[model samples]
Target: MTWRARLLALDGLTPQLGDADRLVWTTLADAPDGAELVFLGLDDGRPCFAAIPAAGDAAPRLANPQLWGLMARLPAADLALYGGARSLIDWHARHRFCAQCGGDTRLAKGGWQRDCGACGAQHFPRTDPVTIMLVEYRGRLLLGRGLGWGEGRYSALAGFVEPGESLEEAVAREVLEETGVTVPSATVRYIASQPWPFPSQLMIGCHVRASNDAITLDTTELADARWFSREDVATALAGKGPFTAPPQQAIAHHLLHWWLNQPATA
Candidate 1:
């Protein structure tokens, strides 16, 4: 059976298929042929996977990419919930130490909290804020190409939230810092969110109205930057662009898709 997309959320995770204990740590196991493992991060004593091909069938299946690609297909609720589990598990695996003092931390409260043995400090899982926005002006969207991505691939502008700022402020600051475009307060609208676990990030998607159209590129962050009409964006989404949209599973892609489907307001 074709695997349907399910979000990773408190409500998204259903009960286990059976009472037999499941493995949490990564292990080498012999998966039956034509099966794909959709790894659900560990919670308390359980780790889950939406084991595809429940029984016997013959077809080529996904490896790791196919597993992660599941995010794009799932609803925001499910993605947020499932990604939450993944992030929590990942944080638990890494935060075995106290940053305040060189102390060891022990897992407590079913993998949610880490208690320090040396200085009595408590640590929790983190969700690093990321501002992902579609900067709009004159019926065009601002796009950028990152250094690490393939050539001719462009997506919405994005950056990390600094120490003392809200999500809207981060969107404005990131647009200015990366592309020298000023985003207005009235136009910064929240869209959706996604769990990006390259190393634990919560990507907050938004639509921003730019005060100016001209771009001043910050070479360290973006290789190239420019404005594209909705038509141009539509072409790109259709896989005909010199630059393409981000992966369909990403919040960036969702923002862009929504923008493309809307009537031009600016």
Candidate 2:
């Protein structure tokens, strides 16, 4: 039995959906000649690939829709596949030129790496690491609203991991820097992680026990920072309350959900 390869074609950042509002990955025979392809691996003995359409043109039979809108609509496996494709495609788009010798680079290693022509440099796709923590002090959890997130939108403290810091260190430093709350190293515990491909980031979720309750908000980083009781968090999670937590797609929501259900730790 001959297995035909499939291609997930993206026009710009939008994916092609079929009449039933499902992803319509093109067969190798239907895929455009110049489309950039990345081998995504085998699915039921049939090879699957992802492609970024060379021209930003949508096929007449397929509907081009933004990736964010399809997150909740697609199945879990499809969402994961789409997220991985987006990250790789975005990396390739940005790294077409080599930094070492200002030369052209071509995709290699099934789109996992880039090889430069003029220089011997090889570049790989990068996934930025970020620390997102739910900070707890006594009975309250620390939530903050970033600038321009609008009123009533609050989430856990998060920041990118700096060059030489551990994930725990990043969590502690982010909480302190954004909300002026100190979370001891011993109190920081890893909870769960999520791949957030808003370009490419791996969000490391942690639970942090704060040493102090008083908050001195960093105006540049946050618009407001405050402690919310367990009741408030529960209400927010239940879709009630003045403040809204991050959506279900974010790691923040899972961290908040986990923290709210745990037995009191004294």
Candidate 3:
């Protein structure tokens, strides 16, 4: 994978595959003169590293994105490696200076940490916790499309887990705040989670049963919200109906799959 700026998870990137459809990587010794090298890890006894350009891109765009286009083509293991590299390198680029004492920080611990020389402060990569849920009322799933999503595309609702809040609490709070759907915290069920590489987020997936079905959309977060029937969800997943599903790489897609596989009485 090649990226000029590695600050954002959705930043512009194009993967390079050579020989037998594998990711093309360069060693630190062969890196460009101005490149920043971060130790990624060992792959089959040899150390892996990410060589980043010194002057990185500041802004990221989503128009005609190549990474998204090539995501499904690369092997799952390769995609995960690229995501990890992006998050680690991005953390380094964004934390060049210490936030506490205005001190210059140097890369330490093989790209896992930063140490402030002036203030003796240590900074580590941040993995923000986020709650993403499939809100259900009766037998239908709640889905919404954000302003930035493509036409007719929708996915599960999500929000950051605020400080001092439990995962269930955050889920209930976010569902209420963004869509005016009251989810009882006790009813929120924990599902599998995915590490969202968009600037490093741990997406905690969950689901809950809602008693009411009315929606009062928070325009700032969602352009529209509605309860989708089980059949509507199945059609969307098949890529031919009520709405388009979220990208396969996203947890939302899996959440929908999980929902469809449950027993009829569940």
Candidate 4:
């Protein structure tokens, strides 16, 4: 489960799609109401991934909330287009009024931007930055049970980066705030990133050295917090432990898997 860089769904498609811009534009224009669209990459133009709505006699399988965790199983084309389309549409949905003057905004720039009618302001999609960190102390990494996550599920500590904070600072502060575990500023390392559109989040992954073993769960954010050794996590990932891995597609899984498999580097 180490990060071997198996062609991630979006990264692999960025290079081969020729004339991507025109294709994406045309696709967007004709996209059905329920079709999922994701922004892939620019071939010769801005590229996009598109998923068609359920055809006649075809049930709306993708629309089921229970199937949310199966996104990784979705075709790369479908995922990319849906990811992009959902992000764009959500942006349009939320930015209906100009923030500066409360004026109405109109979609522009091929559904990528919005122009304010009264304030002359231009609005764009927002990707709220969230810090997701693996806190290591001694030989164990910290994981938390989120109130929102289902039973028996645990994920790395995460929180939205506050105004006036750097990514490293956010890592240290979020770990401390969520688990009462102080993280050293110098030992933080960036691992990976992913666009998480459960609503519109850009997850910044990192590994941090925890200064202490004691955990005081920030009850409002986490139901519990604990440390697990590499062996423990390995079992979880293998589905033999009392707990389980985060969803395979999440960067949290990749980050944890990276740490669990990495050999000691001098």
Best candidate according to lDDT: 2
lDDT of 2 by residue, 1-266 (tens): 44888878566656666655667777876666776687888888888888654433233211332455666576677778888887788777777789898999888988889999888799998899999888888878889998877689899889999999988889888988988888897878999998977678898989888999989988999999988988899999999985897877778988888997899655
- List pairs with backbone clashes in candidate 1: 7-78, 8-78, 8-81, 8-82, 9-81, 9-82, 72-249
For all candidates in order, the CA lDDT equals: 0.69, 0.81, 0.79, 0.69
* TM per prediction: 0.72, 0.89, 0.90, 0.76
Clashes of 3: 1
RMSD of each: 9.5, 4.5, 4.5, 8.9
Q: State in Å the error of residue 200, model 2.
A: 1.3
Candidate 2 residue pairs that clash: none
The residue-by-residue lDDT of candidate 4 on 84-136, one tens digit each, is 65555555656678999999877666566789999799988889999999888
Model 1 Cα lDDT, one tens digit per residue, 164-228 = 99888899989999999888867799988877864578888899889998789999999999899
Question: Model 3: runs farther than 4 Å from truth?
Answer: 1-14, 19-21, 55-64
> Candidate 4's C-alpha lDDT?
0.69
Candidate 1 weakest lDDT stretch, 10 residues: 10-19
How many residue pairs clash in each candidate at the backbone level?
7, 0, 1, 11
Query: In angstroms, how far off is 151's CA in candidate 1?
Result: 0.3
Candidate 3 has an lDDT of: 0.79
Report clash pairs, candidate 3.
5-57
